[model samples]
Target: MSAEKWTPDHLQSAENRSLHLEQRRMQLLPVVDDLRRLAREMAAVVKEIDGIEGDIPGQAWMRARHVTKPLFKAADDIEQAIGDLGAFNTRYQRSYEELPQKRAEKRRRKALAKSGQPEAIESAPAGSGSPKKDEFEDVFDGLRQGA
Candidate 1:
């Protein structure tokens, strides 16, 4: 008669997982944004610093800045990781929504099983036995007996 499939411990654990995922998302969103912002700013600063003609040996630092490829790639990676997590969250939501329906279906099947209705007759396997004619033979039994 119970509609829910989850035990109290299972439900509690599911809630905990959901909360943890949300917290992870919350924490990561800002970090990803900050990384993106830093990447963008690095590009612009590199461009500006390019205007300076430097005989300076610390010019290696400038070389590090002039290329935005690695920075942008890192930002893109962060975004991709966030996107993957979001997908996981979506899947979790869908499974959570479907839990009740799945439980209801299982309960219906179980109830049907327990209701003690005769199971459907299945065809006998090959060589299991000769076909039984008694079901049809009964209808002609009286005619045969009278004759």
Candidate 2:
């Protein structure tokens, strides 16, 4: 239907939201990468310092590595969240695309509703109900119809 050409407002809103989430994801991706990279570099540097120093300073730098553990974990969590959002959006889009014909029919109905038209009800096929013939009809009735 031509109504399909006009995307429903809710669908458009969902599309806009998806686009925004993708943009935000893209923006955050680099930050998460940088965080992970910096965390890794810091851990390496701390380990190297601990190796160069004796017990006292080595213990402090070793503790610093532990403190950075959460940074690495948080960066990983952020990356996972971004991936999850991307996957969700992919599924959302696929679900919408999968039922194009159904969506078009719904759009048609919505357009009709907006135009103040009553939806057309589908009628059952003719003679689908109980037989019109009397149940007590003579046995010859079937033979007569066949003839």
Q: State each model's CA lDDT, in order.
A: 0.64, 0.70
Q: Candidate 1's residue-wise lDDT over 102-146, tens digit each? A: 777656655665775433112222454467777688889899988
Using all chains and alpha carbons, the TM-scores for the candidates as numbered come to 0.44, 0.44
lDDT for model 2 comes to: 0.70
Candidate 1: where are CA atoms >4 Å away?
1-12, 49-66, 92-147
Clashing pairs counted in every model: 0, 0
Q: Weakest 10 consecutive residues, lDDT, candidate 2?
A: 1-10
User: Cα miss at 105, model 1 (Å)?
Assistant: 1.5
For TM-score, the strongest prediction is 2
